[model samples]
Target: MNGNDQVSRCGYVAIVGRPNVGKSTLLNRILGQKISITSKKPQTTRHQVLGIHTEGATQAIYVDTPGIHLAQGDRNKAINRYMNDAATSALRDVDLVVFIVDRTKWTEEDELVFQRIEHLKVPVILALNKVDWLDDKAELLPFIQKLAARRDFAEVIPISAIQGDQVSVLEQAVAQRLPESIHYFPDDQVTDRSQRFLAAELVREKIMRSLGNELPYQTTVEIEQFKYQGKTLHIHALILVEREGQKKIIIGEKGERIRQIGRDARVDMQDAFESKVMLNLWVKVKRGWSDDDRALKSLGFDDLG
Candidate 1:
């Protein structure tokens, strides 16, 4: 068929992996924009973020899900369960699956992710990410082979989500496999999430980055106000923690840490929204919110299975 008469193709593609395997990074790189937040910490992503990438005659809707983790002991909470449910739920009805693994390393979590998608009817592409961090390039083949044997993957490709290495090839593989259908989103739309959700995620990302090892997983951000006034966007975010001690850690001495988070988040907000941003942050102690099912549902974690 001629280029003008080429059939249009669009489909949902789920990017699944263990925590910190660069799922979010790959989605952002593919979309050429930051719809999903990334950090050094695992489980930084909690929601199923849909990044829509539309090219000529193709629209690949990528679902960037939270890492599917094994909840055990202290880690087993309502929030953790919610995250697992969110990740698995994305697999249902997807046309394709991109299962990402970090470099040559495969942990039990990776096995868990593999088990989840092993029985899938759709094509699952095994994306070995973070090859840029590999010290020995010769190990690539063996590692790829090892993972390729685990399942009948549609394709096994090496990638560096951070550096954009071989990502376009991956995108091409995804686009070619998309089933013929109508585009679900506008050509200009990059993500299905609203600005309010992105804003809250950005704030949570800043807190996770700023605190480093001290960061509490129980912390969540809620946008109390998100609206545009004249040429500027105003955001009021409340940071909820499980304990008073965690609240203090986020606040820091003289409230410097929270202010820093606000400043950093506002910059990202401005860049994301393409407008001036006025971000206000406040930390509150919501005891057992993370473990409480009702509290989690109230905080927008109601999308669980």
Candidate 2:
């Protein structure tokens, strides 16, 4: 053992909520960097993106999974599987479940989140996010009362996740539940994903923000290469599309849209990598990629993987 190493407090924390509830946004804020893909559209996140945070003696491993929704096609089925796995897997040994929800209203999905994980036998903190959207206290009070009646979560804290209002309060609430275990990650570890994964996720977030529905669901970001030069980082990436039409749409008139996307994505990737990046971006068609087992597996979206 080192000369000075106290017994660490390490445990997992899963963020579960409905689609478009700003789950990815919350994780990115906590990490002070982007690890999960964020979009205004529903169902943008596809898998459990792990983010590691260490504070004093506590190490909270956050698992940001896809939104919980009813299953439909194979893609939807896969997303459901990912959400269930992320929530319950950590429930087995985790110290907390942050049941995130919108503050303005409570929906069936929110109820489902409580019902699904109520048996975890650990603390379930009902984090009422997006309070900034609520203009009146009366509008949020009933929702909080409803959540309290559920008897499903341990504590309900109102917070504006995007604006970061009362986030410190929520953090303190979560930290209070952590057991005195050893730290699972190093002190400086901000997230569990590598640089390449974060680069791809940045690209994906750019596509979702720039292209909207036209190409958001049909796309996947893959980092083909990441290398270091003297002062700049050399990177190669592929924007996987399922159709030729989507590719053309992404490229846009005279490749203007692609250039815009590249600029935006490169800026974010550079900030994430902390180096000037020479990014090479290419768009390719994978033909119904989300449903194709091989393509999904290749992109690390498979159930087994």
Number of the top-ranking candidate, with lDDT as the measure = 1
Whole-model lDDT per candidate: 0.92, 0.77
Sliding window of 10 residues with minimal summed lDDT for model 2: 74-83
The sequence of per-residue lDDT tens digits that candidate 1 reaches over residues 1-305 is 22688879999999999999999999989888889999999999999999999888899999999999999987799889989999999999999999999988989999999999999999999998999998898998987777667778899999999999999999999999999887888889998788999999999999999999898888999999999899999899999998889999999999999999999999999999999999999889889999999998899998643
For residues 44-130, write the lDDT of model 2, one tens digit per residue: 887777788777776788878777765566446443555455544545556788888877666776666667776678788888888
Q: Please give the distance, in angstroms, between residue 41's alpha carbon in candidate 2 and its true position after superposition.
A: 1.5
lDDT for 126 in candidate 2 is 84
Pairs of colliding residues, candidate 2: 8-181
Q: Residue 53 error for model 1, in Å? A: 0.1
Model 1: per-residue Cα lDDT at residue 304: 47
